[model samples]
Target: MLSFIVLCAALWVSFHLIAGYVAQRLPLDWLADLPIIGASYGWERGGRCYEWLGIRVWKDHLPEAGGLLRDGFSKRQLASAEPDYLDRFAHETSRAEFGHWLTWALALTFFLWTPWQMGVFMVVYGGLINVPFILIQRYNRARLRRFIARSARRSARAD
Candidate 1:
C-alpha cells in the first residue's frame, strides 16, 4: 500500500517534470496542429464542448506544472498579444497536451504492479487525473490558434 502510494506520486510528478523539459526543447514543427493530439475537426470550436464540464470555472485551479520550464508564464491565462509570443504560447499548449497523454499512457505501469482489482482502480485514477488536463490543453490550443489567426488577419487589414 505504501509502495503503491509512493509509486503513483513518483510516476505522476516525474512524467510531467521530464515532459516539461522535453517540451521546452521540442521543435515547433513537432508541436504543429496535426491529428490525434493535435487540432482535429471539432477542436476549432475553442472548447465550447468543454463548457458543460465547467472547464472555465475550474480550469484556473489546475497548477501550471510546467511553468518553471515553460517560460514562466501562466498557461491558465494568456501571456501576451505579441504575435510571436502568442505563437509560442499556442505551441506550449500542444506540448502540454502531449505531456498529459504521455503521462496517462505510461501511468498504465500502475496496472502491471498491482493486483487486477487495484490495477483497474489505478487505470481509472490515471484517466481521471490526466484526461481533464488533456481537454484543457486541447481547448486552450484551439482558442490560441483562433486568436493567432484573427490577430494576423487584423494586422493584414491594418497594413
Candidate 2:
C-alpha cells in the first residue's frame, strides 16, 4: 500500500543521508579501508567474542627500525613515480578494501539475527538496500577524486 511505499522511501532517504554524513566525517581513504580492517581485526581477535567492535588505539611506536633502514634505498625510486599513478593506485586499493569491509558489516548484521530471520533479512537488505548504497558511495568517491584532482591542477597552474 501507499503507507508501505512511504515507509520504504523514508528508510531509503534516511540511510543515504546517514551514510553520507558518516562517510564525510572520516578520511575517504580510511573510510574505505575501515570495514576490511574491522572485519579482519574482529576475526583475528577470536571472531567477535573478544570484542564486538574493532578498537583503534592511537599511538606511535618503533618496532621495525630495520625495515625503515631497508626502505631508504627505495626512497629515490618512489620519488621518481608519477603522482597520478599513486593516486589511481590508492583509489583502486581503497575501493577493494572498503568493499571487503561492507561485506563484513553485512555479515555481522546477519550473524546477530536469529537463524531463519537472518537469512530473510540478508536476502532483502543485502541485495536491495546495501548494494545500492554501496554503489552510491563508490560513485561519490569517484566524483570526490575527480574534484580533488581538478582542484590540484588548478592550484598548480595558478602557482
Candidate 3:
C-alpha cells in the first residue's frame, strides 16, 4: 500500500509537471488552463456528467445559452444569471504550482524515510494541490466579469 501510494504520487506529480510544461509551450494560455479547469469542474460535478465515458459535463452543456454562460463567464455572472447556482470555478492555474511542488517534496521525503506517510500525504496533498486552482480560476473569472460589467455600465451611462 505504501509503495502504491508513493508510486501514485510520483505518477501524479510527473503528469502535472509534464502537463505544465506542455501547456506552457502551447500558443494558447487556455490550453494550459485546462487541467485546472477540468480538475475543478470535475470535482464540482462530482466526477459525474463528464466522467461517465471520459467526457466533460461542461462540454455537453456548451450548446445551451445557460451552459455557455456558466462556462464562459465568471462565478459572479453565473450566480447572477442563475441565482440558485453557486460559482466555484477557478480562473488561475499557476496558483496551484507551488502546491504541486510541495506534494512532490512530501512524496519524495516519505519515500526516502517513512513510506507509511504516503497515504496521508496523498489524501491531504491531493486536495490541497488541486482545490486552490479552482478557487483561483473562479476568482480571476469574477474579476474579469466585474471589470467588463463596470466598463459596460459606464459606457451605457455615458451614452
Q: Which prediction has the highest lDDT against the true structure?
A: 1
In candidate 1, stretches whose alpha carbon ends up further than 4 angstroms from where it belongs are 70-74
The per-model lDDT (C-alpha) reads: 0.75, 0.40, 0.43
The alpha-carbon deviation from the true structure for residue 22 of candidate 1, after best TM-score superposition, in angstroms, is 3.7
Give one digit per residue, the lDDT tens place, for model 2 in 1-159.
Answer: 799557545644454444333433445456445654322332233322222322212111212111132121111112323556445443543443344334434433444444766556645664554543333333333443555577689879999
Find the candidate with the highest TM-score and give its number: 1
lDDT of 2: 0.40
Q: Which stretches of candidate 2 lie over 4 Å from their true place?
A: 1-29, 35-121
Residue pairs with backbone overlap in model 3: 89-138, 90-134, 90-137, 90-138, 91-136, 91-137, 91-138, 92-137
Decoy 1 TM-score against native: 0.83
Q: In angstroms, how far off is 124's CA in candidate 3?
A: 4.1
lDDT of 3 by residue, 16-108 (tens): 655444433443334335554333342434324324543332333322121222223222233433312222222222323333433444444
**lDDT, model 3:** 0.43
